[model samples]
Target: MTVPATAAGRWASLWGLAIVPLLLLGAVLAYLVATGGGLKTLQGPPVEQLKVSRVTLPERGVIQVHLVNDGPQTVTVPQVMVDDAFWSFTAQPAGPIPRLGRATLTIPYPWVDGEAHKVALLTSLGTVFEAEIPVATLTPQPGRDLFVRFGLVGLYVGVVPVVLGMLWFPWMRRLSARAMNFILALTVGLLVYLAVGTYLDAQEFAAALPAFWQGTPAVLLIALLTLGVLLALGGKRQPEEAPLGLSYRIATGIGLHNLGEGLAIGAAFALGEAALGTFLILGFTLHNITEGLGIVAPVVRQKPRFIQFALLALIAGGPAILGTWLGGFAFNPVLATIFLAVGVGAIVQVVWEVGRLVARNTAALGAPLVGWSTLGGFTVGVALMYFTAFFVKF
Candidate 1:
């Protein structure tokens, strides 16, 4: 006879239905209470620190400034300067930037100095917020560029374990179906953490946009689009017959996740925070190992060739390189949210597939839904991420 879930295990299923909504409600309420219980609209000089959100070259003879308004009231900026040179916005911004919004200024610049330059903004009351412009690189030094990008963009340390694991994939195929299912479920747990964490990380960044155009909506839209794309791609194909394809799906999801990691690294580096960039790289590298295991878990049954495994790894890992390149040069909060949403959507699909596989295997063994082994495996998978997370923020 199959055993029933215990009191604690019974609560776990409901958690899936209840926790996110409760937390979201709590977050909304906390934000309201913390900000005087409602949105405040105003215009004046305010005593709040302004931050340089991003700086970009829009065109020749032009530099664009994006200022993040973390203040309670909207404030009018009277002037902005680059180093000792004065510049004016070509066109005035529509209105005072709302709280948690970003303001943009486009200034003409005739110089193309390769050296670092500082940009400053002055409010009506003479409050100044300044940030350094990233030094321009006119020519590419391949070796140095690769070193900086890889070391800081999250492609290093994780490779060691991932490589070793793939080397042992041949032996893994010998494991029984139950063993593979345990591993599959465990991988699902790891991705469970990833999907949730990825969305949470983008929340504040998404909040910087206008209230109507928030990250939540964008994420939902992108996730749905990603799912539609995946489903469309698999039109009329059975999951069982195309077992090798499952690995590709997993890799694609992991690739999307890694691309987000690259964005973090690139954004950090672009803003001149090398330490944060390095920390992000290290954390992502560790996750990359677990991601590799998640990708290869299907191979345990399919017995894919080494060439196939290598291609899957590249499929999953190559995006990190491209993401780093783009993120360092140009990043928009909206785009970042979309990238993360895509990853979340794809990973959720993978989790569903893995769960179905696990259910079929466990049903054969007469195990309960709350079987200790499966639960233990999942808990372990979730805990594994904590090791890297503790050492550095992901």
Candidate 2:
């Protein structure tokens, strides 16, 4: 019943292909077991680590805290203290929180306005975790009033400015070839600044997450993955592809960046920082006007219709409203960090594509790509962004 040599060779090849994956899987299992699944094993006394992921003042005299167990074992929060005074509190899903598990604790404390307060949690393992409120103010609750307020902010910061910038399309269409290159270079500069800022913001948010989440590595991986995916999606445009396509892509990138901006504003307001939120509105309004120019640069040559321009404006600015809603109602540090990373990646992709367009334009004009106009335009773009950023603070 032995198989023929030809059939036996085919079977051998199939087995070989299957064995490679099987061996690799076995290796992964062995590595995981040896490293204890990348978790630190407590060697001595009960080790507990807790993270205060968020704090909210839903009403005038009550505090809500979100907690996550970021340790190697289960930990129970047995006592709570506010401002060094013992206070009674209730925990949702009362019990010990296992590794990476989450819970919410509500405490009724008469916190005064314009003052600082400290909330402390005493764990079963005799470890204390403290969360500080730098300023006592009422957190924004989800409601029609809050929704309308956030919407107005987004409209001012995202939509109005972008539409105004797009208004320059008529003027942009009249520029010389050399001048067009300069404008495109300026767009690249603007996008580069945005990308860097978004990435830094992502890192900041990542640092606020629980230690067990490996936030830094996660941000790096997600940002890189986003960049790779976007590049693949926009690898090369065919001649038949309309210029509107490129413009839409640019709008999409700017829209994502604006979404991050909206999240920042909403979170600031959620934390009751009215001043910071107001400043953000002003700063982003100025900063994002330049984004409209970037979006329209590719399409000006195409002479796209008015309806097309309207679509571009919406595509570029509409996300801010959605972002505000999420950040105001359900802000999560991990989600915010991921979104910022995505914005960074999208902007980087747009910058690459825009740079290529600039280079191509320069070559068509038989001029040097890195001339004075390009350099100066880029400098001005970066400088403008930096100057506007003075309004946005952590």
Give per-model TM-scores: 0.67, 0.89
lDDT of 1 by residue, 235-323 (tens): 67786756678878888887777777677777666655677777777667665677777778776767677788788877787777767
- Give the distance in Å from residue 251's predicted Cα in candidate 2 to where it truly belongs: 1.1
**Candidate 2 residue lDDT tens string, 235-268:** 5657557468878888887888888888888887
Candidate number of the best TM-score: 2
Specify the poorest-scoring 10-residue window by lDDT in model 1.
Answer: 134-143
lDDT for 374 in candidate 2 is 87
Show model 1 residue runs off by greater than 4 Å.
Answer: 1-53, 56-64, 67-78, 81-154, 157-164, 210-212, 228-235
Scored by Cα lDDT, where does model 2 land?
A: 0.86
lDDT score of residue 1 within candidate 2: 47
Each model's total of backbone clashes: 0, 0
